[model samples]
Target chain A: MAIEVNGKMIEIDEEGFLVDREDWSEDVSEAIAGRDGIELKDEHIGLIDYFRDYYEEHQVHPTMRVLVLRLGGKIGKKFHDHKEYEKFLYMLFPSDPISELCKLAGLPKPLPSEHDG
Target chain B: MAKKNDEKGTTNPELNIPLLNELEEGQWPSFVSDLKQWSKTKPQVAQLLNQLEESYENRWNYWTGTVLNVSGYGGGVIARLSEKADKYPDLAEFHTIRVIPPPGFVYSTERLRNLADICEKHGAGILQLHGLTGDALALGFDNEGTFAAAEELMANGWDLGGSGPALRSLQCCVGQARCEMACFDTMKTTRFLTNHYISFLHRPELMYKFKIKVSGCANDCANAMIGSDMPIIGTWRGPMQIDQEKVAEYIEEKGVEHVIDNVITRCPTNCLSLKGKQMVVDNENCVRCMHCINVMHKALKPGKDRGVTICLGAKRTLKIGDTMSSVIVPFMKLETEEDFQNLTDLIDRMWEFWNDNGMDHERIGEFIARVGLATFLEGCGIDPDPRMVQSTRTSPYIKFEELAPGLFEGEQTQQPKVWNREPDTREPSD
Candidate 1:
């Protein structure tokens, strides 16, 4: 399916993941968020940026477990505890934290085999 | 649209049963009209229609050249749609339907005809009466016409069976409905639970498929003890009723050896004894198998003041070996709506605990086994009791902390630290 972002048409798959990864921009993420009934808040944007940066560096989306460990061990400025990070993540996105993050971050839907725990 | 078997003239057993149209005039009336009326609000009818149509289309491909391969994670209705429906004209829009029956399945001829008529109008005019789950399945249909067929089915009052990791239709024995030995209302309990958890029946987000089966008494006609995730068994707290006059008559008519060899000796627990003319029952030792009662139906009967014994974590082997449910609530009266609420609450707590902690594809029984029974009981607000003991090896072992000063030392005569109670150590309320 195609979504119009600032008068530019961008393609996405049936599940709403970005069809052409290079076509993604902030405007594209906002359009996707609009379709998902979620407003792209400052916190969500920060998390999405973090996921994008992580993906760009590693060529793979981080699982929830890796995200928690990274936040607690190295990226400890915002949240030091894994449990607190999880709580904050859920506070931002109630259902399906990873799915929402990937959608906004322009990442493929994580396979069911991949654990979010 | 019946598929031809290798034997050209053979009739399909699944499709050919007691036909609805051929029944006697006064026996039962057609329910197709009733089904159409009921279809207005139920959304599953439309969904099932789409699935069945897809399945029929897939089957056509299988018959011609392509292999019908349906693979997935969840268990529910196994729908097959042709992968290359656009390429093959004959395969387009076909679908299959599998329907699971409720516990103690008893359907009138009219009801069977209603199902058959729905299939005949929309599909290949075939029905598989006894599927894997003992459910009725309609084999073939096309996408364009199946919706109307499903709507009529719903109007006639049929719900899809449970599939996936949700609760299956709660199975129960024919309890107080007909049986004299029944301790509780099995039918009422089954209906209430089925209706209350209907959404859970369709949704498959849980760890795995969960089943609840109820038996009116320990005879376990429903086979709940070994098969279900949760088994509710009926038990009488009192002794078995014995008619001394009938016992005396039996002794005189049949001889003392017969009663001694058959009824008294057959008690599995050795709980029965013949004392002169009276038959004595050690109620405490009785397993309630109904063996003696079955042998001497006229002479013996079940006691009054009946209630249910709830067991948990009984299931077939998956990750662990096969295990029978251990008595959770030894006994509870399942009478009022409040009592039902309590039962549901217990179930809710168990589901929440299992869902939160259980791994992907793990069963509730497996979760209990992994976490240990003590942890489960403590999490569910149940106190540790002797009745809750499952095995000597796995039972809760007391960890002895260092005794306080003067306890079990020097001439201190107070009760040992083991017997010392905590503030909330009282037994759990029924």
Candidate 2:
């Protein structure tokens, strides 16, 4: 999938997941981070590697609950705070223009489709 | 996924709806409004919404009628009807339709046609094929042919209803019957349970919504506990195979490395123990989660004494409060249908108590939890089992002999920043 983010078209990698940093335009990173349900921080840039490692091993993104559990276990911290997690995830993928960001990152198409109708 | 956005512009008379925010969710879900928004960006989704909305359309009569309870799945249809209003004059006002489908079976296409034909002529063609599920829906059907459609479906060996409070078709995710994880034959037990309880299903006395989910070796793909009022979980009761025995060699063949570290260790019980080229499960510590078995499928096998744990006092949802689902039948061998029938008899007694004094449509969990557990047992003339009762829930925590600092030094992490502000208050302890 390709999208014109910030006036430049970037192609999503073959993994059906975007990997290139240059491709991660401000909006794209925000959206991916949002989809991952993580807060975007400079520290989170390395998150791509972590996600890659997780995907390499599991062959899939950790679903929201699984991600939280892994995070809690890895860091020995409780992910009991729901509001912070939700906000952090959104902070990475601000929904101001969700569609544009989702497209640039090559996320799966939204649930309902033309075929469904 | 629940969020519906606006479509860009192609406004059609049918799908044009008002825009609704999260605030209006409790007030009214204006699906039409949200679809209007989605159509602006994703026109196709709006089209699908229209397709689904048509179920509410065209020449319907509303008859407020109730009938004797036939099956527990019957209540879902009632709940569905309770959701609708008299506003949709285009749809037939079918107050009720008897839910009779094969117990623990799904309907095929041809049978669907016959049921549709029958319901179309006699009752309303609105066949809501709502079997037993947590999120069962009320789908629109043609009233004219629904009865024939139901019949047609039955003729082709399709089931419409079976799983409810009455008896459910024991379900598993292609367990040992096929999957590498199952310790024994799950399909055998499933068929046995269904074969034994043909009469209990239609009986009204034991009619309570219940579901029994069995995920052969844990990896709870079926989510048995969350979805069912009475959850029957599979477990083994012997030594775990941790040595490089016949199955341990297949651990790598089955790709059991990465999952072992994550899934096995996550077992709330410390039942999973690992050795060189071997993975073992602790019979006494195991809580039927099957995580260890799932993670190390090749190295692990359930013991010969394989059975199910029947947890009672449970419900599908706890949106209101902490509903009690207790371990009633702690263990039962699946060798015969008699075990399944014993479970059914217990369920019938539970239903009789709830229906007799439940006051208002109080669910089984609510009714049992409202009155003391003792009262429920006394009413049903069931002998109390101290081992399986509610008070025995205890965590198996192993405390290592080490300094707490050594154990906890790497535990510190940045705390989450909370945004919801609150008025200042001080605690006496603080």
Candidate 3:
């Protein structure tokens, strides 16, 4: 199948994802995050990159737990608190975001959209 | 559909005569034993006989699936499935359809013809009507047969929802749809949830049981009192949606006494004040029984807060027990799918934790109490909630305003009178 990253699409195999973040523009990342009711920010780069890497390797995006566990202690202890954690969550995944994030990410439209915002 | 129950005879020697499986038989021999004797009586069909016998012993009345719908609450497909269950001799588990009757519609011209036709063609004619959820039940059909009827009904564009773990259909008040107390868009919400959670209806693995109820106004005519796990009682927080001209028209059309009797006196909260054509509701005292708004549809509109109050733990066995509805989410705004999803996710997490950890047949609320809400939340890996249980747990540092909104201020919530309340303790009506 062809990997559609940004506007410039490339052919890719089913076994591996179309990684190489260089292929994903800031617009693409922001768009994908926005769909999950999340926004992308300069500060969210690390978490987003982490999510991207985990997805590329494991073949599935990090769920809330993995997101928390991977970034919790790193982001400081306050991240564990529901209110604060939710704030951080809302920060990385804006209330809503860009567009065509799923197509940019080469995924299907079967699950609940993340961009509830 | 026409498979004969050839082993219907009391004695099929190929099957074993029933033998007692346990030594300490009570007033009734072990169901296994009774079945074994049945097997002997029908030795040729011993295997088939034993399956039925074991099913009868293992879990009857413990839990049974009832397909619910707004119409045929008293009579419909449920009655049909029940009528034919005896014919499918091979199946072990039997299913019954519980019909949800359309509110305020005790009688309708349609006579639930679609379901009746399906029943007449596919199931036994035995109908059980007006179940707890106002659903009608069709006894005598096994699980597969019932499912077939469901599929069969789907072909005719008639759906039977509220069977399993998925979102049950949203029930509406006899609202402006029928009654006068309705304000918010109930039929729309009901349609929304029903269409939204179509995937959940057949997937039974989600939890022990999940129920949803909607009432146009707080009159809770649908028995949000103790009917559903998440009770969405319509409430108006902002300005009333009352259209004065419409109110006059409604009164002129619906009559004054009907409105007064059904809307005013019926209000649990004495907030409605009526003087001929003009009526006022003390917003402060209006407990949202929805009567005034429903009856005075032309005059009284639902307040801006026309959303529903989502209180958890309204199970017939657990939350409904001991008296009183323990309101969880005091109020919720279901204006969007995201809101519904958030609410459903919370329900999903609760079920994942409780169903896995709880003893069989425990309601989610009861399980939370048993496992400790804190531990259960921890197990579910949800955001921390310091105060969820009602068992007198309180924080020393917190004041009413500072407290977690989910927490109760002490165990001082008002208790509702159970349906089975003692007549001696009951007060006489004025």
Candidate 4:
């Protein structure tokens, strides 16, 4: 399957992940998030960027706990505690922050075992 | 979708189940006899027996598939399908619904009857009073039948137990309800924790299965120490209560030789001794192993100040091997709501650390093994306690520089040298 971004057709997998990582761009992310009825905000994009960076460095997606911990060191001075930061992340992507961020970031879907309840 | 079995018929009398007949010949009560008795009224049982016989003959289990979950849930229903369904069509889709029983497993006759009726109507007429994990097993159902039975069970105040990666049903001993040695109310604590984490029980999203078992005292009737991820065991601080009169009476009845052989010698801490006719306990040295109290319940009792000891990271053999739980919190007063909330917060912290660091299919215990226990404790922000360690380090290679920085500085003008040298920074050789 495929989705159209900026009038150019881009291939995607059945779960809507990008068929090619190189095909991913800002416009493609917006198109993917738009399909899920989520308007891409700056915070969402920030997490998406972190997800891409972490994956590039570690060859794995950052778990919710790792994301919260690393993000706290990076841009979480506003939040008093890690729990509050986690709550903020959840508020940004309520269903599953890690998987949702990965999708918008154009990364492969995480293992089902890593998904939270 | 499969059709329901014809409930009007009985077992075929001409059918020869030679393998199953052998099971009924034993002196001990046999499950074969029970199944045969139920087969008289429920044809599903007879078909299941036939399937079992076929499995025994072929040296292979016919059961497979796990797509028997109820709506909006991913667990609690285990599929038991027969691969030989073409031959035993009636036994094609056998399943078991795991219903979470109440804390303490107290049940009224009416509730039991209702459960039996539901099983008979929507499932095969068989009820395993309790499964290994303490959930009531309602056996033998198809896909649609499972939904029907689950809906009726929920409406009648019964909920399904957990399976897969979810938090399993909380198992608690009948504490304070019937047991005299109980240090706290096991039922209340179990019920509260269960209700609080009901979502975790119903959902299947964790890395692997987690279990919590509560025991009322150090006797650990619930097998909390080795069988669960989180073990809440009742414990006491300070001296245990000892009635001298009752002690004398016990000595009179059981004899001094019996007391010396059974209670005194068996004390793990070697704190118990006899002073004339009265028994003496070295309270300061007592580890509260519950051996003396169990043997002489009439004379000895738990201390007045009682609470629970919470431990973490226990599981059966899997990755690293069987590991017993380690004490995290030596004592926690589980009386007030705030206390329970604090316990919940601790669990949340531990779970967060585990979920982030744990690999797929890795239990919390294995996670601790991968990352050192000190790292796990520090990551969860748990205060390091002396009781958490089984014993002080026996090796002389202690990190004294990190532990005690300036112990010998002022006293001897000699500094403690750090034993661990810096890593070799030289380039690799060809």
Which one wins on lDDT? Answer: 4
List per-candidate RMSD values in Å.
11.9, 25.7, 17.8, 7.7
lDDT of 2 by residue, B350-423 (tens): 65566557643345677776776557766877644545555445521111221122435576343322211232
TM-score of chain A of 4: 0.84
DockQ category of candidate 1? incorrect
For every model shown, what is its TM-score relative to the native structure?
A: 0.62, 0.49, 0.46, 0.75
Q: Residue B284: error of model 2 in Å?
A: 3.5
lDDT of 3 by residue, B63-148 (tens): 23333222212112322122223533433334455443443334454667766767645444344455555455554454456667
Provide the lDDT at B126 for model 1: 52
Interface root-mean-square deviation of model 1 in angstroms is 13.1
What DockQ would you assign to candidate 3?
A: 0.02
Best by TM-score: 4
CA lDDT of each prediction against the hidden true structure? 0.65, 0.46, 0.49, 0.78
What is the C-alpha lDDT profile of model 4 across B1-430, one tens digit per residue?
2233552233343445899999889589998888888887777678788878888999998877634446556568877777876666666788888888889889999999999899899988789876657788888887678889999999998998587677888899999999999999999999998888776676454568888999999899988888899999999999999999999999999899999999999987788899999988899888888999999999999999999999888987778888888888989999999989888888878877787778878999899878876678778987555467533233221344443555556553343332233334456635
Model 3 stretches astray by more than 4 angstroms: A1-117, B1-4, B7-111, B134-136, B142-151, B158-170, B239-282, B290-301, B318-324, B336-359, B371-430
Per-residue lDDT tens digits for candidate 1, residues A33-85, read 88877788898898899999999998988765456556644544321122355
- lDDT of model 1, residue B193: 86
Which scores higher on TM-score, 1 or 3? 1
Mark the 10 consecutive residues where model 2 chain B has the least summed lDDT. Answer: B396-405
